[model samples]
Target: MSKKCSFLYGTLAVVLGIATSGSMVGSVYATDYSGSETIDLSADITDGIIIKSGANITLNLNGHTISTTESEDTIYVENGATLTISGDGEITNIAGKANIFNNGTVTINGGKITHAGSYYAILNHGEMIIEDATVTSTSEGNSMVVNGYYNYTSTDERIGYVEGKGIANPTMTINGGTFTGDIKNCIYKGDDGSINNISGGTFSGAAACVLQNVNEMTISGGDFTNNNSGYPVINNQYYDDEIDKGVVTIEGGNFTSADENSPLFENGDNSTIEISGGSYSLEPDEEFIVDGIGFNQQDNNRWEIDAPEEPETLPTVTEEQNPATADDILTTAGILATLMLGLLAIIGALGFNKRRA
Candidate 1:
């Protein structure tokens, strides 16, 4: 064999062996897996992974691990791209943000996601929704954090601590799954919206579910537990300036707070708390006053929420016009005229009979 050809073949074999073994890693660029293909991260993916803009990427961990030891973000869902996870896989990042920005969604149907650093496990700015997923934060101090901003800012000084934050319009809808963390005022829904927790999953946090100056909070189902005492489970006090503007509706769920002051507080009269159904075990006080009905409980700890029947609407009545005494006199005059005509006719007939005799 020629010396040059033999040397080229030897180099190719060594490169192939490294790729086959799990020791060496691969640097997959954004364009490499942009199509409808699934990029399996079986090997160690060194450096930060950025699902660049304009790529509809499905990151199938394939039961692999994506570990990073850096202060920067490990996996970045850039503009217009998506990062979806399924099956028993894991995404681990310490000391950096798991940032999912503009128009991106981080959907985890099944897998274990650990965000251990001070950063958030899921930072959703655009639209983030979860179903049958497990999102956990092991960070001791604060497990999760999410912030949003208005599209524009007035002045640099006027810009508060959370100015120019995430998307102006961000949505967080948790339909099903389990989220375990000790969040502070961590989850921040924007001005026009709020966090909606429907049926399914478990949400446990030390701090209150802060609903600031925004719209209503409709929680139909789920399990919310606060082991702490005296602090309300949901605090609309953060929306002090716009207290009456904020509203909360809790139709169904199993809600509990270990502390006496842990009731869901409605700061203003307009800010209502309606309990249509679901079992709740809360030590109530003056601070935690719900405007609507409270969930009743039996002897056992199990709560019972009755299915509310629809309200019946009342029938409408029409009003009549006023009556006049003059109309009654007119009716009496007609009766008198008929009686006089009969008397005259009888006298005329008796006079005709006398003339004939």
Candidate 2:
């Protein structure tokens, strides 16, 4: 081969090697976090972050992004582990499952978590706390769901008994954050012992802002909005016979709805709502009443409702005694004139009798 030809071939080989190395450098695999560790991502990650058992991990996005293209959670926290996310980063999951499947505790202090075409932004079976963050679900699913599982054991006649255990209930607490979604329910609590507490944040949904099933919910300070029609801003539905009642207490917050027919509170089966202090405003056609129920005005800033009751009616006036007719006025004046004439006659008769004596 000529020298020029050899130089050209060497140049092509060098370009190919560089391209291959660059591709290798850009590709990132799934990371398994064990023990106590902190990982700060400097580039976009393509795989998920897994926290193994007995691990306490903190994954800081560091202004980067973690994305997953598969139908899986972007971050999976296993049992007996904890994951804390900090920094103003992003976690994008273009999957069908939840973006965060938390079996253990998961705390998000600052970040943006988005789930597109997913069931939920966060399916928490353990505990989740969002202090300052934004979580969104961009599909027909909920933005956040706190659910539970059941455990059972099956025994075979020929073999030993097999035991299976799973999550039972979950809890979520939001101190300051934003949860928005265009779905059936933005925030849902599906199992017993599932509790949701919102001290400060903004929650909006397309159909229903929140739906709790036989659970307890407390909201101190927040803003809740529902955009759809014929649905309440907060709906507490009964689960089953075993757990027939759900309780919701609103100490302080702001509740509004875009639908005219939607009330501020909806109580299903055996649910109760106690509003201690909140600014609840609805559309012109909307009201602060419950559907097919009654509420008690506990105080100036509080309202409690437990069961259905008849509304109180105002006392009826007797039409102000027919507004004093003309006949009545004339009769009263005649009686007064008669009394004056009798008094004058009695005085004249007494003077004449004294003169005669």
Candidate 3:
């Protein structure tokens, strides 16, 4: 073929490729990964992502932003979808809608979620795990992570902060993250039958690091601080419930409050606070402390679980109950037998000497 014909053929192929590119725009558009593909955001998105069902997508922000000016979720996750957000990027919402409204499962492995809105940075009505991320709520009433409503009678009533939208099970696990907010909670759960697990995080709220209301919360580990003068680091409020089964079990954490008058933990209203383990800048109130558990207050004014004392044990001597073993008994018998034989020989020799004389 001639050079001109070859160039014309190449241009045709490029045009055909653009015409056949369905939803996979690669970088220009925020689309699905029907083949479980990773989409790197080459530019900031004004219109947010509404993930389709059964689509598992990994969106790498790549130091870009996924911001929306409209009053809609920045990332609307539908049911049966799994969205893994990674890279050092930003997800912000200028409107009143949530930055991330999850109805399926959303795992934030890394990113920054900041919002200047009336809603939460994350409004979850499904399973959400924040492994390592930063979520900041600047407004006084805005929160970092809030869960939608859940059906208490249904078995789907699981972990999350409830009070928004849903027919889905709300479960939020904060494994590792940096959450900060103003008057509202950095993390909160108020829904009936709500259960939240915060194993690791750095949470700081002007009001409370964790504002738990009438439910279960297992804070295995974290660093919590509250700047509010009236509220504690963990403010738990339990109103009257028919089941009477809501409990806040704080297994471990580092609690601190800038307000010296405020306690690290506050058993507000009718809440039951079971603190088996934690390190508090100040002492925990007697009502909140677990029974039979001791806290060691260090010189630095921090209080933690007292070191477990080792039980005094006697030294073991034999396989069974004995000071003298079988070997000791046998040796004693042999020595006695030898002495008797020697005595008998001496008597025999004396008798022989007398007879000889």
Among all candidates shown, the one with the greatest lDDT:
3
Compute the lDDT of residue 325 as modeled in candidate 3.
76
Highest TM-score: give the candidate number. 3
Report how far residue 236 has shifted in candidate 1, in Å: 2.5
Q: For residues 85-172, what per-residue lDDT tens digits would candidate 3 score against the true structure? A: 9999999997887888887788999989987867777877778888999888775564567754533544442333333424433667
The per-residue C-alpha lDDT of model 3 at residue 217 equals 72
Stretch of 10 with least lDDT, candidate 2: 157-166
**Local error of candidate 2 at 227, Å?**
2.1
Question: Tens-digit lDDT track for model 2 on 112-229?
Answer: 9887774767766677888988877766644365453221122431111122212444678889888777666646554554667779888777566554555777788888777777
TM-score of each: 0.62, 0.64, 0.74
Off by over 4 Å in 2: 1-34, 141-144, 147-167, 188-192, 211-213, 241-244, 282-357
Error of 2 at 128 (Å): 1.1
Q: What is the lDDT of residue 225 in candidate 2?
A: 78
Alpha-carbon lDDT, every model: 0.53, 0.63, 0.70
Off by over 4 Å in 1: 1-28, 31-34, 99-103, 140-167, 182-197, 205-216, 237-245, 266-274, 283-294, 307-357
Tell me how many residue pairs clash in candidate 1: 2
Q: lDDT of candidate 3? A: 0.70
In terms of lDDT, model 1 sits at 0.53
